[model samples]
Target: MATCAAPSESDAPGHPDRSRDDRWAASGAQLRALVDAFRSEPVTPARTLQFEHDVQIVVRELGRQVVPFRYNQVEPAAAVDQPRHARFEHETYTRVHAKTRQNVWTVFGQLVVRRIGDRPSQAGEPMLFPRAHRLGLVHGASPALAARACQLLAAAGANQQQILARLRADHGVGWGVKKWRPVSRAVSDEMGVYRHDAQVDQLRTWLAAAGASTGRHKPVVCVGRDGITLRLRMKRGSLYEVASTSTVRVYDRRGTRLGTVYLAYAPEPGRPAMRGALTAVIRDVLTRWEGPVPRWCDVTDTGDNETGYDDRVLRRMTHPRTGAALAWVRVVDYYHASERVWALANMLFGDNARAVGWAKTMLTWLLLPGGVNRVLHSAAAFRAARTLTRVQKKEYDRAYAYLRNRMSHIDYATYRRVGVPLGSGGTEAACKTVFIQRLKLRGMRWAKDGAQTILNLRVVFLSGIWDVVYGRVLAARPQPIMGGHVAAEPNELEIAA
Candidate 1:
């Protein structure tokens, strides 16, 4: 994970008296020695677990040794000349320290940097450190470390404590909550700056590939949305919040899904941000498609948010270039519709062996052509054959109406025959991956920012654009120091897995 900064000489820690030439020469020799030591080590220690563990520690040590040699070489973003007055919107700031020492965290651990600073003459005004911001430090963590911590935070079954533990064990980096929280929060926020564009670009490529692909049927593009209840950090009398996950997928003609783009919103009223994000990408792809459009379909349960996203956003979208409406085959997820039938079966035959037999028959019928209608008819016939309690009749009618009303959506046989999707597996998988797997772990409660810190990383990783998007973020660091009018842009740093 090398940064793109140009090499420059700086005195090494504990050797500040050394000349610039002496420092560079010593660093070069030290780096070469570390490289030789690395080559002497075994490449693969998998045969012996102990050897593998030993090799990992050795590699980490080599990487640690290399950090200062390169990090100190990153050209400092300090202001030139001794001109002092600085205007920010309205107030004026003055140079406070010609150079100040600060600790910066990195994957190799911490490094002390001497950066110039600025502050308002008024008491209580906080000093600003421009070099850190220009170099894309997330608070105190370097760009690479910030990127690493964010990816680690997305581990499927790991909670906050476990995440920090893994960071220490796997990477030999120490991180405590007070230091880690703000760094990750800043990185997640930085990731948001490039989220929409990166995903849109990803989806465009997928759509183009899917359209050009030759197959038995048109390439299938799936639209999915689902929601879950997340336990929030005990706040002013609210224990739960609703979070939503949405996905867009493209499949080749043979019904093989090529890839998927995922979007998750922690909690917002109507999730307008999420809605606008999806609308932008989906609309862009449909409008600019070079040839035939993929067979677009929506797969979701009849939940309010799921159906609402379809009805309002995805259902009858109009292409910007062409005035014609974009079409989507809205299918109710077969698995969910199956549950509705099973509900009726339970009501029709409570706690009896007959219930299993009836529900199994209905579940199978759901896959046949016009299966939902048969399910309704069969349930009615069963009720007619036996006298039911008052409550039983009420529950039966309720369940029957749910299936009856969504008759148009539960055409699994037709969907199967045509090779359209019958389940919202992508969306369900996303809910688990983005929300349930990490956020809903036992005894976990999250603040809005805390939740977004993890959700932002999860969405980017699951969309398969971590490397692309994060690089763009690190490249777009804030410009100019607090007291200076101009400064060179920091080099782009790319993070790789």
Candidate 2:
């Protein structure tokens, strides 16, 4: 007993160093225990309840234990009372740790201030600087936009202010307001609901429109050598004249100029409006003509409303087969025929002479078999042909109900071999691009003068409006009042946070 046999390896002092064999055996035993715990049957509800009750009984029985150790040079009474003092010291420690916590760690910061209700309750205490409230009114972006901006800012090594400024300049402040906020870890929890609702509404409107517009209509092909007809309204205050015009240029299969028909009114004494009306009609008809044809009509009416001018002038040109139609080659049907042809040539090609040569070549090609019809329609057959679909027939006979003629003289199969646009959409698309892109915007309300200037400049710019737009805007300060309200002013205060 006095010698105590040198301690066995298992009873060695608690040193960190361990033998390989002992470590291996210990790890194997631990793994076995872990596997057994995982595979064991689950505790039943009654067993769980009983176990919880056992834990409660054990904790209650342990209670609080205190020991006295006033070994310092103190009075006898103080030494005896040390255990009572120790109990009070622990009570204060427990109160501070469990019940009397002053600062609660939160999103904004360790919460330094909180206002409880009069009765010391949760009521009336606003969650100060809630993520939702702060993300909207105070910030320049919705939470998601702000978060994206924050990410970009971080990558760019820029501050929140700089990112916000860039966003404002690019998209406008009003557009992105609600996204300004300090960078937050939990941004996903702060997204605005309104943005998603707006997107859903837009999809609904699109689906409704798609569902409603589903009827098939025959395409109207106007047989005209010049002009695609378009409708317009001319208005001065209360009185507005709804009208159409034909001041359009027609192009052939190769995008070559056919003619320019200026819709002009019949001249009359003291009837300016009526004259303008007929000219407007001519313009409209020309604008709407769908394809190339020989029988394009230009409207003309006598000034006096007392009698309507005979529509025969228009009808004769519209019905080329009626013998009254004037051949374009005839000099009598033209104005400054040589000059007009020369200009047309210039439009078709850079060199007028080359264009003329090309035109002659096209004329020879038009007489081939593909250009001529294989079957001749009798009067009866002509009448029956009128019942055919409008889109199927290239031309409809104005004189006879069924005697339809083809619109384009060129063979479409051959034309396809060459690059040719089926519709003259190039010029129309260009016009819309020039007009709508420059002038139209959401919620745009235009006044006469402002619209006219912008439109003129837009067309000018589109037609090559750059020089005029720059020169005019530079000539004077762009008017404060444009389209409607004053043009928005640049913000003086810096936007970057």
Candidate 3:
């Protein structure tokens, strides 16, 4: 078996040039200083505060001093070799500046580097620093700090002010909303790339497992979809307009939610667009299955377009590679159907005790075997017996049409017996957890791209995949540059430090 060796003192930042013995002597001196400081003060709240302050000062000072040394150790030398391309001759980069100073914000506080810079022979090109560029330190903040900020905003659902406050309080890193906002936006903007990369990775892993014959029987998959309204600012007016966010939650046989995906856009994408979005989500989930393909169940409310789309678009969808159609079982949400029944009862017999009793009776009939037929017959009979007003007549007609249309999907008895869910409670709860809890705060109005970006991050965070997505986003960041050249590595350095 192969074993990995631990990093030595020379491999660590700030200690690269120092021998192990010298490092030990320095550590002893620092420990003694700390001990002497503690001995100089009694155990009081004021002394505790003083100690903390001193530690902060020492850490920041160390960071400032060591960052330059670390940068120099790995800085590309003058006239470095370059790869040859088909159309261009091989070239080398020359040192442009012996030393150039740049400041970067980091978890350890602001670190300044004054180091040698390199540049390509070509004119009008940018400078580069191999170590700093590799460390993702050429921008406003280090990639690590940007990633930390993204985590705070995405997972914590914190506003700019809250993120700033927490970073200062917990990490001793001071930053304003102005500095934090762009970092977050830059991270969120890569949502498309992150999502695509993740899906591809998942599919590749699944395919590998299946090829190795290590796949297990697939579990039952339940899909719940619903929509929630968002208040967004209007271009023409001071007031905001209502926009809808569609959400889909997938769960395994054991009722453990696998993931939740969301689509929130303005001007409401028509039925076709909405259906396409849903189809992509379903396909992505089903494609990663191993062994037997799982059965699917869609639990949703009785919206005309939503039901039609599921039946026509989602149920008919086939695997692009396997050509297997999804075995989808449709279900109308029990509560929504019951609400229609109650509304019919109230319209026919006012909102008194009689209406309540009639509604309860109809609901009971709706749940029993052959109950949909009985409920329809009873509703028709009640309408015939009572002389309804024009408005009440319209309500009666709507109730009859609603049940008649969804009669095929309302098999509550079999669903109850087989453990299939009858209601879209999961979807309802998802609306609150995925979107409302974060986006529906007071005075929160979002621009189109901003809303979509945050929604993407929110879903990724809620689905327990924020780390994966964020890592991809960090990896996809533009290559760092220094003094007029693309930084090339002589050998890999510890960028994480």
Deviation of model 1 at 100, angstroms: 1.8
Candidate 1 C-alpha lDDT tens digits along 270-318: 8887888778878777666667766789998898877888887776687
Cα lDDT tens digits, model 2, 170-253, are: 323322223233322222112211212222232233323323333331111121111111222235422212211112233333
lDDT of 3 by residue, 289-317 (tens): 54456556788886666667776777678
Give candidate 2's error at residue 264 in angstroms. Answer: 18
- Alpha-carbon shift of residue 451 in model 1 (angstroms): 1.1
TM-scores of all predicted structures: 0.81, 0.22, 0.76
Highest-scoring model, TM-score: 1
The reply for model 2, stretches above 4 Å from the true place, is 1-423, 435-447, 468-497
Better of 2 and 3 by lDDT: 3
Clashing pairs in 1: 233-446
Off by over 4 Å in 1: 1-66, 73-97, 118-130, 170-172, 235-238, 349-355, 481-497
Tell me the lDDT of model 3 at 437: 70
